[model samples]
Target: MAGIKQVRNRKLLPDLRKEGHLSKEIVLSTTEKHGVPAGSRLFSHHTLASVRKLSFYHPFSIPEDSLDIILAATYDHSYEHFADKEDLYLQPETRGCETWRRLRNTVGKPPKPKIPLGHPMKRGGITERKSPFSVKLMNSGVHSSQTNPGYSRQPAGGAIFFY
Candidate 1:
């Protein structure tokens, strides 16, 4: 295995700023394979004014994050779900194919797990009055949001970001 190249915000911040993203850290380094994973590279395009991150969506990794990252972790994970673009990067490059598209068609995105509260409706609280209602009364159950374990227990508030 190659040695890790520690990241410095002094350098990373500039790149982020060029891409319209900003960070205030004076230093940044990633020891984990995921953070600065191998095989990643700097990609440039004519349209980009400055550096913009362009990384391949490798096999989807479940990063331990206190909150969702790039709105991805928020995906309903009650069941295994792959991103829409995953198959595109496959060795065969099977983009725009039905095989990948219909993989989960039969089993749609199911609702997240939840505990049905008691009520004639299975929903907590009384409907109209003390009269109970059954699960029939409630079309949905109480649902809660979830986040994976934190990759690191860093204080979110202290971080500085430029708009």
Candidate 2:
């Protein structure tokens, strides 16, 4: 955690430390695939204070729990949230008979291979990391399960996930 700097003056999630575990603020990439529990509560907000404090993107409270379990919301759901919603997935425009897109399909499309680098912005430096394509997102109906994180039994599933 050498280069990590905790954000100050921000309200943490309620009951952040009922147990001994700590909470972290996560930022996922647009091309990444993360899971949220089927019915887990998902929310968004931009407070005057928070907006002022954060420079890049307002904090996205990706739950370490409520959204920990597995779900069936796995459509072509990009890690598409705010902020990069525009830069990563810009819309097309038409002028008279000409229709042009700000991006080319190959800019970030198939046939073009994606390299497996660790989460670059994560606090610690990157080590050779394994792909989480097999993590078992356990079924649950509550926040942080009595079970470990959705990643305990890591290499359990397959690449083709079904709803």
Candidate 3:
């Protein structure tokens, strides 16, 4: 984001000025007030003029009526907790999507568990069958069982096993 800002400040500003979209005095004054850093080769004296022009025409400098119109048209106020009843009522319905409905319905309920409790292992029982893919992989020698000859070792007499 900073890099983009810097490019706008340096490269884009100068280009706009060169195209006569900005004035010479604006360039000189802006550069003088907020001098380009020594390492900023792209943002020269000319870029400063464009920046000054841009600052004068900033969105915040827009009239209150225009700003209000823009805000009313683009800003989403539906999710604001402190929004007035009128504002909430005015918002377009966004509950058609499953995710939006789920979000709206989540109030006061404990969040669902990360791991499903319905799986056989979680229910304190082992699945008797392996997945077909796992069986195929094992038969293809791509996945070997720990009890196979390549991995198996006799337990040492001194080793203590724990359940």
Candidate whose lDDT is highest:
3
Model 3 per-residue lDDT tens digits across residues 14-49: 323222232223333233424556444344443333
Ten consecutive residues with minimal summed lDDT in candidate 2?
Answer: 100-109
Put down candidate 2 lDDT per residue, 1-163, tens digits, no spaces: 2333223322322222211232435332222123644233233322343333444433333325423312212223466455433343222222112122211111112243344684435567776776765454566446544444443333466343333
Query: C-alpha displacement of 63 in model 2, angstroms?
Result: 29
**lDDT, candidate 1, 1-163, per-residue tens:** 1232223332222322211332332323443324454433222111222322233212224335644333432234456466565422342113323221221112223354454674334457655654354323435445521222343333677543433
Clashing pairs in 3: 26-49, 27-49
- Taken over the whole model, the C-alpha lDDT of each candidate is 0.32, 0.33, 0.38
The alpha-carbon lDDT assigned to residue 106 of candidate 1 equals 26
Q: What TM-score does structure 1 among the candidates reach?
A: 0.13
RMSD of 2: 29.9
CA shift at 57, candidate 3, in angstroms?
8.6
Q: Cα miss at 64, model 2 (Å)?
A: 29
TM-score of 3: 0.19
Off by over 4 Å in 1: 1-90, 96-122, 130-163
Alpha-carbon RMSD, candidate 3: 17.3
Model 1: lDDT equals 0.32
